[model samples]
Every structure is written in C-alpha cells, then in structure tokens.
Target: MPLGTVLVTGGASGLGAAVVDAVAREGGRPVILDRFPTGSGHDEVCVDLVDARAAEEAVREVSQRVGGLDAVVTCAGTDSCGQFGDVGGEDWDRVVKVNLLGTAAVVRAALPDLEARHGRVVTVASTLGLRVLSDATAYCASKFGVIGFSRALAVETQGRIGVTTLVPGGMHTAFFDGRDEQYKPGPDAKLNQPQDVARAVIFALQQPPGCEVRELVITPSVEGSWP
Candidate 1:
C-alpha cells in the first residue's frame, strides 16, 4: 500500500533524508520535523527536538497542516561520545532528551491522529541499543530506552497502531563527521549506506493491515557492531 502522508523527524539528513526520498518515490507525501529546514519543499515543522514540549507541538502542527498523519518515523538522534564521567552532564542529558524523550513526545502527540488512521510508527534505535560499548554512555542509554519504549508501546497499542523498532548499525552518513578521530569509523570500516537502511524502513512500512514488522535490525554484511 502507499505510505500515505508520513511524518519523518530528522528528515533533512542521513537515514531520515533517505527515508523521505524513498517515501516520495513510493508515492507517499513526506512531512518533516527538524531543527533545520529540509529544503525539500515539503511541509516542515522546524523545531529542536531537545524540548519535548516543542517536539510534541511540532508533531501536532504537522498533523494539522497535512490533514492528519498516517505514519511517523522518528529518526532524529544525537549523541555525546565519552566515558560517563568525562562527558558533561548537560551534553549527556541532551542526548537522552533528544533521542528518548523527544521520540516519546512526538509519538504521544501523534497518537490521536495515528490511532484514527491505524497508522505505523518506526522508532530509530541503534545497534548500541541491543548491546553495550564503552565510552558511549549517553548514546547507549538513549538508544536502549528507545528499544524498551518501542516494545511496550507496541503491546499497549496493539491492534490500534503499528509500532516498529529499527536497530540500525553504523551507516555512511555525516553522523560521524564531527566526532573525534577515535570516535569516527575507520577508513575501511564497512558501514551500510543510509539508503540501504531506509529501504528496510520502507519494507516495514509497506506491510499490510493485520501484519506488522515489530522490529528490524539492518547492518552491513560485514559489520561487527552486532552479535
């Protein structure tokens, strides 16, 4: 089925941008909620995801402008890579607020519209969500929270809304651009392209009614991030 009007957080870049492009290709209208303009000419609600209230408001605003939402893909994410004690408190907390709290707020606000349409939600988690690593306390914590939240939400909204948790491994995007050298992927590191992972998201979204993809883990074939 067509994706209908889908709201995508972080739709300006990375996997989110890829999803937006794919959605358009599949004949779905893509609406964006991001801190920066999408520049894609689609409807957008530009707001920072750190403020849960603002994120919630943005979701509502998008729904109103688009006439309602048929699905939401929460792809907005931030990370502070450092040892628990080394990362500044505010930085660490911001990661949680944006990655975890923001996702909840957006979904919370979209529930009414989504439930009305029996919509789908795809929350972007990470391989870190399934496993642990050193010096990535904030990112790991937030992603792990997403996994738990998505699971419970699926059960809570069973038969009313479809929820899918996407645990993606490293991808080729600017996600690692500003990181310290040590935190960046090695030159030869095999990472899946954002478009590849976006295709998986499309797969999940295309599932017919009464059938849903509860969780998806897409990684590079040789990726060492997962077990």
Candidate 2:
C-alpha cells in the first residue's frame, strides 16, 4: 500500500515540516494542521491546536477533504523555560495545553479515520520526558504526560491502530529561538537536525501491517538531555 493521506500537526516548521517534505517525496499526500499558513500550496488546515475542539474539527476537515487518512503525526509542541515559580501562569499552562493536550486532541480526532485504514500515529515526546531538569517544570510535566498517554494509547488500541512515540533530544530548529540565553543550547551543543528525527517518523509510518514500531528514541550521540 502507498503512504496515502497523512495529517501532520505543526507542519509549518521544525521537525513537522521535515516530515511533511519527506511524506510528499515518498508519494503520500501530507495535510498540514498548523496555526500558521504554509504558503507552499500544500493541503493545509490552519487552527490553534490548544483548542481541542478546533483541532478535532480540523482533523475531520482534512479527513473528509482528503477522503480518509492513512496516518497522523502529532508533532505540535511548545515549551516555557524557567523556574516553576518564575514562569507566568498562562505561559506554563500554554505549554501543557499545546504539548500534552493538543497531542491527545489531534489523535483522538484521527482515531476513527485511522481505524478505518489501519493507520499509524507518531506522537512526538522529548528526552525531558524521561529525565528531569531544573527550571523545566512545564516542559517536563507536559512531555511526561505525553509519554504516559502514548504508552497507554498503544495498549488500548493495540492490533487496530499503529502508535509510535518519538522521544527526541535537542534539535537544530527554531524551537529554542525565544528562550533565555541560559535555556538556549550552548554554542557548541551537539543537536540533531530536525530532518534526521523526521526520517524516524517516516520509518514508523511505513511499517508493514501486523508490525509496529511502538517507540523510538532518536538523539545526538552526545545529547545532554538523554543521559
């Protein structure tokens, strides 16, 4: 079977954009669900993922327009760095909403279409989800939630839908652009490229029926966060 129609949240940039490009190159139709417009003329549905209902609606919209989905990659994520008590409430809350809740919303919305096609889901998690760091309460909490959620989801939907949780370390993307100097990766930080991690996503999506890549951890050799 072909790659078919796949929905990628946050497909406007970073790892998500890389997956979109890879999916298209492999002959699959990549539908984007993002807050920003791609301007590339690809099939897209622009919506803020923090709004679970709106995210769900966007998935339905894409599924209907594309004639059903074969896969969905929840790559949308955000982080607010600072001491737990230092970060503003809204910023902290937004991290959880966008990372943990948004992932669930998109996947839940895609479940029906995925079940119909025996489709795949690849949810992006972080190394922070496994190891804790100071001043990273919001990001850690949200990513940890993602870890738990994806694991349980895999068991619950076993034999029906393919679920893979991608745990990646720091990457060379704009994900750290607005961070404080202390929070930003150091000048010599060995970060993997977003495209590299994205290839792993394609690998999971391409798994043959009756086979599943349940979880993947892709990080740079000297990744500081993973250890």
Candidate 3:
C-alpha cells in the first residue's frame, strides 16, 4: 500500500525531523508531535511526551486532523553520562520516564488508530541497547527496555502491524551538546548522520504489508569497533 499519514514524536529536531521530512518526500502527510516548534509547514502538535494526558490529547488531535494515522515514529529521548555508582536515583528515574515511559504513552495513544489501519510503528532506540558502555547506565537501560518493548509489541500485533526498533550507534546530533568533556565522546569519532537512520525508518515503512522489520542496527561504516 502507498504511504499515508505519519505521526512522529520529537519531530521538531534531530532524527525525528529527518524522519518527518522523509515521510513528506515520500508523499505522506507528516504530523509532528514535539515539545519544541518544528517550524515545518506540516501539521505540528507541541506537547511534552512525559505528560500522559497531554500525549494522548496530542495523538487524538493529530489523528483527527490527519483523517487517520497510518504510521508512528517515536524519536523522543534523552541521555546522561555518569558512572552507575555516581548516578543518583532521581536521574535514573528521569531518564526512564523520558525514554521508556514517554514512548509507552505514545504507543498507547496511537495503537488504536494503527490497528485500524494496519500501520507501522518505528522506534528510535540506540546501539547502547545492544552493547553496554561505561557511564551510560541510564541510557542503555532505557534503550534496552525499548528493544524489549518493541519485540513484545510486535508479537502482540501478530503481523497485523509492522513494529521496528532502530538501533543507531553514534549520530552527529545535538544529543551531545552542552556536555562536559568527560561526558562526551570524541568529535572525531566516525558517526552516522540522522538522515542515515531516517532512511532506515523509511525503508521499514516502505516494506509490503506482510513484511516486518523487527530490528535494525546501524553503525558508521568507518567505525570498525565500538566508539
């Protein structure tokens, strides 16, 4: 089937924005749900994903405006760098709330419409979910949870809807902005671009109805080993 309306969480910037533009380029109406202003002409809904009620309302509003929801791409996430021992309980909780719980809210809110349309759900997880890194406990934990969630959801859908988890290694995004030297990786390290992962999401969405792409792990070609 042809592409239809797509809802993207965190679509205001970074990889989410790339996915939004990709969908638009592919003849799909992009409904962006984000905390910041996307400034894109496509339908935009500004709301905090951490707020369950607000997320639900945003999904409802966007789905209503778009006529129907054909796909969802969740790119809303945050990260912190601190040794497991140094990270405080509150910090861990915050990361989980944003990366895990926030995604849960979006999925819950959009599942009904997706079921009706037999659409796709694409989640932007991290390669950290597959491999552990020092001082990235919270990030790894949340992404791991995302992987598990996607797998379970895929099983529950039973081929009715496409569910995919995108695991990208290092990306040249603002995810490292405002970080201390110790908390950030070397800039020279080869990294994947947001557009690279966006393309993967588009690929997953473009597959035929019966096909499902469960997991995609994308890393920089030059980066032979973990960064």
Candidate 4:
C-alpha cells in the first residue's frame, strides 16, 4: 500500500526536497514545514523550527489538516563555520536550537500521531556527528546531539514507533552556497546526490510493520566526511 501523509521538515530544498519528491513518486502525500513555501504544490507551513513551542503547534496543525501523518523526516539544518569564539553567541546557539532542539520539538509533537499509525521518523544527522573537525563547532555539536537523541528515542519508542538516525555525508546542495571559501569543498570534491541519500529514508519508512531501521549511514564513494 502507498504510504500515507508524510511530514517533512526542510521540504523546500536539498535533501528534504528529494525526500518529498520520492514520497510523492511512491504514491504518498507530502506536507512541508519550512521557513518559506516550496512552491512544489505540497501544503507547506512556514514557521522557523527554532521555536520549540511554535514548531510543535505547527506539526499538530499540519497533521490534523493532512488527516494524519504516517512519517516525519527531519532534514532541516544550519551551519556557521568558524572558530568557536569567532562565531557570535546567538549565531552559534541558533544552530543548536534549529538542528537539535528543532528536531526534538517536531518529533515530540508528532509522536502521538505516529504512535497511532505506527509511523516512522527519519532524523538527519551528519557524518560530522560521529567525528570532530575544526571550524565547525556548532554544526558538530548539534548533529552529535541529534545522534544521541535519535538513539535514546528509538530505545524509548521501541515496539511502538520506528526511529531511524541518518548519518549523511556531504551533498550537492545550497547548504554550502554561502559558506566562506575556506569552508567550501574543493571543486573536485565528491558528494552524494540528495535524491540518492533520500532513497535511504524511503527504505526505512517502507519497512513492514514490526520491522525498523535503527540507523543508516550513506555517503559518496570518494567522500571525505565518512571514514
């Protein structure tokens, strides 16, 4: 059977957009939670995921409107690369708020609905989540936090809801568009296509009842981030 309504954070672009398209191709309805509308014809809720309360309310509202949500994909993320002290305090905090707390808020809000439908959640972490690097303090911390959160959540929600932690390496997206030259990957750098990475999410979501994909790591063959 086709998957039911799927809620995707950051569904406006990059990896999330790919997931949205994949869900649609598989005969599922996709709804978006983004700071701006994607114009891809999916119903989109424009709200910053940083506000935990607002994020949760948005999820509830969207879920109600969509009839019910069968899955949630948290692919929204932000990064500010620089020395720990070089980045502004608020700027650094925003990364943590958006990447870590934002992920938690949406999942927490969607839990009741997911439990009702025995739904799945795909939380997007990063290769950085498993390793340390220079000039990416905020991004690293937030993704690492996401990894920890997804693991505990899986344990807590086992036998009820499916939780999958996605450890994705670099992708060819605007995620690096505004980065400083120093932070940008080299021209020859290899990165996975967003669509390819998103397919992993679909695989997790399509698992038969009582089966779950607890963790998945996907990257390019020549990727630098994944060891």
- The numbered model that scores best in lDDT is 1
Models sorted by lDDT, best on top: 1, 4, 2, 3
Give the per-residue lDDT of model 4 (tens digit) for 1-227: 45788999999999999999999999999999999887888888988987989999999999888888999999999999999989999999999999999999999999999999889999999999999899999999999999999999999999999999999999999999988899998999999999999899999999998888899999998777877
Cα lDDT of model 3 by residue, 51-99, tens digit: 7778888898878877879999999888878888887888777788778
Backbone clash pairs for candidate 2 read none
Ranking by TM-score: 1, 4, 2, 3
Backbone clash total for model 3 is 0
Global lDDT for candidate 4? 0.93
Residue-wise C-alpha lDDT for candidate 2, range 17-54, written one tens digit per residue: 99999999889999999999989678999999778889
- Top-scoring candidate (TM-score): 1
Model 3 residue runs over 4 Å out of place are 224-227
Spell out the clash pairs found in candidate 3.
Answer: none
lDDT of candidate 1? Answer: 0.94
Candidate 1 residue lDDT tens string, 20-99:
99999999999988899967898888999999998888888879888999999999999999889999999999999999
Worst 10 residues of 2 by lDDT: 218-227
* lDDT for position 219 in model 2: 94
Residue 187 CA displacement from its true place in model 1, Å: 0.4
